[model samples]
Target: MSTSLSSDAAVTGTRVSPPSESRLRSNLVLVTLLTCQLMIVLDITVMNVALPRIQADLHFSATGLSWVMNAYTLVFGGLLLLGGRAGDLFGRRTLFIAGATLFTLASLAGGLAPSAAWLLAARVVQGIGGAMAGPSTLALLTTIFREPKARIRVLALFSGMSSAGFAIGLIVGGLLTEWLSWRSVLFINVPFGLLVVVLALRYLPRAERQSAHLDLPGAITATSGVAALVYGFISAASHGWGNATTDISLAAGAALILAFLAIESRSAQPLLPLHLFRDRNRATAYASMFLAPMAGMSMFFFLTQFLQDVLGLSALATGFAFLPTALLMFTMIRTIPRLLPRFGPKPLTMTGTASMVAGLILLTQLTDRSGYFPLLFIAMILMGFGIGLAVSPLNVIIMSNVEPHEAGAAGGALQTLQQTGASLGLAILVTIFGTTSRGAGGSVQHALVSGMTAAFAAAAGIAALTFVVAFIYRNPRPAN
Candidate 1:
């Protein structure tokens, strides 16, 4: 469905006010934006820790349990572009508040859901809210803070939150699940989301709107294409790749995606402008971004299970295990600006991806009897450092090239590809783990190791490719 307002109307409807002097108000705005972003990222991993509890409470079968995540991701990824475009066409502040309200209501509904279907539906709605708010967070930051050095610092923190939030979610989810109940995980969003809505209405500045139009065909085709593809992979995880339904879903999804490309080539206003990929560095950054997260997301998924099931750790302890990684990531974020000025994005990205690949490969060697001090902790630290170095620079590179008007769309596309990679990677790795464990008489440790080894190896290969791509970048240094 298209929004009624034109971009010009959106721009002219809201007047840009003089910059306010209230530091407390500005900080509140930043906190609200960060909180919304953290909520979105945390949802991806938080549910993982509560999966067992959710299954028991809702009587979900093994196959059905995957839907809890798939439902949210599919809608979130598919609708991202449309949501971003809408933010540009409508006032971003307006869209942000609306999204926050929707998200809070969805959370309340999800917490009180009486059946599996009800919960899944709520998750899908939550994804829609996330799509509306996610891109606006970055785009609004770009608009408000135009100074280069200041923007870089803010973006670095934003990028760090995006990466580190997943790990934090695991910790928070574990504590909430252990102390209260799985339902609390959903309910917790209410107070925080409401506060964001209030602060957003007060502090967020509106921009002069352009006469932008929604690409209806592009939105429909792209969303359906991505959702279909995600469904195919998720189905393959449980039903086997050879299943008739799986084949049909994959074929249909591919055909829809092909159709989307054809439509985009001719559209008056494409949801995803094809010309964005013409820049060699942007193209490479996008590809590497996709590949880097493939193994990273899988690591979180399986590692959480390993900590609890194989290593005999309590939920809280498992959360604490990730502290080293999170700490390292936060530290690296602080150093990014200084490092980017000297070393450039290309070398930093290459080194970071290589470190991640190395860490993932090392983690593959883990067994049920492995010690946490050496195997888990050390590998996690490496992974953190790699992600910290890669993610922030990559974000800087992507946003650095885009015009201010297109920032929302660009950010949306970047996040769409990133999340799609995460979802696809999880589906494939989970399938491998499931298939291998079945043959090994349900040995969770053996299954996990097998899956993680393959994933890490793939990550390493992708990193090697990213190193080559990084060299294609013309100007590696950040603009002064």
Candidate 2:
């Protein structure tokens, strides 16, 4: 079956053809996008489970080991706007294939790395590939599912996969690290990436090439700014924030970020269109996306360490412990469409964020004697539900209100914020953990509580802010 494009002045003026074999082809596209999304999300958490092994194998110093995660996240977040623009200018399909290929190759390189430098370089390349591919996934979905109802359903599924993918990654990472080898975690991306590329080539509708110009200044400023900020935070994890170098790095990062905003406001073609945040809902969504992940990512980071370092669980068992959280998150996602119409996103998001806060607060009570059954289980469930509830609605709000022509940019910006949040959150939380851990004289239990309490307190504060933000969202009129 084929689709035909027609010019519509009311929409973007760029003609969009409806898929001829809508149901089958649409589902196929969804699967392909989900696969890509899952791979990217998995990369974030999978390495976490294997950090210890990677460190031991490569003889990496504590500061250097974080490069395994930071390299990927920094590159991915930095180049995202460029990638999104590439999709618009070239074609989403072309970019997706190229990105997938690059990602696959990088994964192969990372798997075989014999030294910390090799692994870190491979991770940077992987991030570049991910930056290219990730935005296209959401862009393709937007172009394919134009209707409100259909788009919401697709977005819900996509959002759920994204939220739950980290947990799934933990499980997969653990299984691979425990049963096969830590290297297998990186190697596993090979088959999945190849599969996504092949399926995308066959199933995705070809998009018209747009002649969009790259926002070079905006891109440079934003990327460098974010990198500096991330570097400063990570540096503070090891060097005290009062250290001259740490202060200099952070001050420089802050200046660059401020300059990035200034450049964006003046540029005709901004990499991150500042106008997207004009809508109160979108702005609030962006803020919530950033803060929500700050605590959320820290939870996974420290918790994984606690499980292995403090509780003495094998990697495999540690991964299994998170299964319940992943399951509950997926379940909550399925209910979003039904619930959105009845209650609207405001109540759901507020409630979910509150639940997450509760979970994080509960987690602060952990000690050497705490077991997985009651304390860990309850915390994981709350975290999952809170994140699940916020993620779906957040995506819907960001994409739902934007014009079709801007979908790619909006999606890219949304993802960029999400990743940046995760990276920043991890850095800050690591600092808190490291500082407290040091002050506690290396007592694992005391350090865990000190870091977790601070992290959870921040999370609760963010959630409370989100509750106020939810008030900005107007309830949609009930269906007659």
Candidate 3:
């Protein structure tokens, strides 16, 4: 494994500089990159709690409110491959700075926006920036930590940040909306983004642009295809599966994706390296990564609603309620480096998914009257451990063996799968919840609870499916 900063390894690992100086310099680089990654992840949910305030402040119609979020998802998910290709072609460090700068500026604009249209415009730019930067962050990380041990450790941190982000987004959104204005959620990214940009210029090493030809046809179809699929799912969430628009989007997406694949197979220079999918282990890892999020996201979506809607918790309280899971997840990162080398990905993946399944199974029994105490609390803890255990190893498998040339596309493909999987999963679960809730004979509270329980059961099944996937790993190899 080759790392980004040979200087870093020399300073910190070999003590070419004073150990303290070396560690601080290397650590700063890690912080700069991961902080950017965290900001992107947080933005996904941070606005959720502030929706009402945004609507009230901007005078958004009901339909307009949905686009604020949808605009970001469609653009971000759609442009990721193109973004990654641009990174490899133009230089990742250059793309990273440009992307981060755009995102930061967009955040500021969004915060200052006076009208619904203005905010929506800013959000769409934020998605573009996120698309540009997101793949580079992980690809750069994979490039930087050449040493296997160090790569695993840094990746654990990255994975942990991603896993905890959903909860933290709710928490941050709640606190900002409660203490300041809803604008604070968007405003918070500016300072951090500026810091990342400034530090990236000084601390990060620059790579020369690759000489590969851009696969324009592959890029266009892939981007449009992914964008359509994401829009379809987002539409399904709000409008249900039967909506003509949803059906049209899904069909168009599938057709476009097929076209993208056909183009890739024949292209001299593919936007996404078709060769990356040839290895069974790597392909399986990609599949598991997609499924893992698909299984887990329902818990976050439904549980948040249950807390605020059924449990009568305030926005702030609802945000804080996720701390048990968040804290435990962060704590687990510290131990992953040790556990991964010892037990290998197979056991860890199976155990992690099994734990999540058990936790979701417990959630399947929830009633409207269930408290945050025994049942909800325990479920969170299980999910915390499960996520912490599962994600790092899976990320490693997708990332571990890449040629330097393909790093950008590999990272993009990995994340694209995740984003696509999450959107589709949520759409499926939302549909399930709606269908089950409608059919159940109960009062409003009971109906909501019935839907939630049914959704959770579906999540458990997804987790179980993940466990089955992990079980199929033959002659398991140690991550180290």
Candidate 4:
């Protein structure tokens, strides 16, 4: 749900011998890719638990602390489209390695940062690296596994890593901050990144570059447009929607996006293919992906606050609390490929959506008196498994039947909407919490719970919309 990877068995006209050695080699390659994905996803929130510590050690102003996260989100979301197309044209493997390398070096620089400016600059580099590598991570996975079923299994794992990574990031951040220091959160990525780089060098094949115009105009508009939109959402979350900065950023973002879409419609070599949305199933899948995160991200943000502000849980305990969700989610995701042949994407998506909705409904029952009890634990489990169920099929549907060259762009758009949803969800939910808490006539704890429950209900509504989208899926069998 935190938002959003594949295989290759050769399908000859005649049955070919299954290459055991080839499968093993592909598995090794998958390890490299998943580790890279885990690193990227983990970094997204790995610093979250350590933010207070970061503010203290770095003497960050209360207002400035939010930038630590926003700087990464803005750049990362903005350049995703350009990065996707660049990978498609320039060679996915090349771009992946370059991006991963830059991210690793930036992590090192960030870990050693003596000032807030230095850290923020490093975070920007990390975002750039993430955008360049993120789309290719999925694109390359599909390239390696040509067989449809194998690709689905790999995608399941790739997606499982993403959903799990967000929760895992919280845990890792807490442990690092508690046992070591806030610096450890940034330092941790260096080793992971280096390992991914080394393994990729050993295992990944160099892609043949496509011959095409670089689409500089598309790149410019897509980058600036998405960046502006992300900034707008960030500003909204921080300063409310009425702020001039938020209004300007949001309006500029809308204008730029419209311009970008117009360009894509006419351009022969568009960054995002307009035709991808022609398939009702694929379009619905993308919509579900966008909505899924609106629920999931808000849950994470509000629940974290509830754990701390209401229940008075320590950072370490709060981090560990999410373990049930992550574990259940990972378990369910691994089994999704098996279910796909029986129930298909539509059923799995609907079921997952229902489970998530139920989970959010349970969360709405939280009160100032509530503790980490059966209800909270059950809700976490449901939320985790629901997301695992819903996300993989959507990815399979999007990547399925996609032309090999277009995989990067598809991955980019999928993730771009996803990140956009995450930012916007947080903004909207935070606003809801503020309004409800202010209006509630109760003690501070009651007010906090009131606001949280309101947000939870809204999150449930968003999650239910995912079911509506999933219900639109008419395909009985998987594509490709």
- For candidate 1, lDDT tens digit of each residue in 355-473? 88788778778776787878788889998998899877777777765777777888888888888777667667767776656566346676666655665565556555655666776
Which 10-residue window in model 4 sums to the lowest lDDT?
A: 1-10
Residue 311 displacement in candidate 4 (angstroms):
1.8
- What are the runs in model 1 whose C-alpha is more than 4 Å off? 1-22, 441-444
Candidate 2 residue spans exceeding 4 A from truth: 1-21, 441-443, 476-480
> How high a TM-score does candidate 3 get?
0.95
User: What is the descending TM-score order?
Assistant: 3, 4, 1, 2
Candidates in order have lDDT scores of 0.78, 0.78, 0.86, 0.86
Can you write out model 4's per-residue Cα lDDT over 44-107, one digit (the tens) per residue? 8888888989999899999999999989989989988899989999999999999999999999
lDDT of 2 by residue, 1-480 (tens): 122122221122354434444445566677888898899989989988888888999999987887888788778887777787677767878998899889999999999999989999999999999989988888777677776676677777888888898899999999999998889999999999888889888777676776677777877877787777766766676676787877887888789889988998998867777898888767877777777777677677778877887788999999998898899889987888677767777788888888887888888778767888788899898989888987777777777667656677788878877887776666667676666666774566767767666666666666667666666776552121
Clash list (residue pairs), candidate 3: 3-144, 4-143, 4-144
RMSD of each: 4.6, 3.9, 2.6, 3.7
Return the TM-score for candidate 1, rounded to 2 decimals.
0.92
TM-score of 4: 0.95
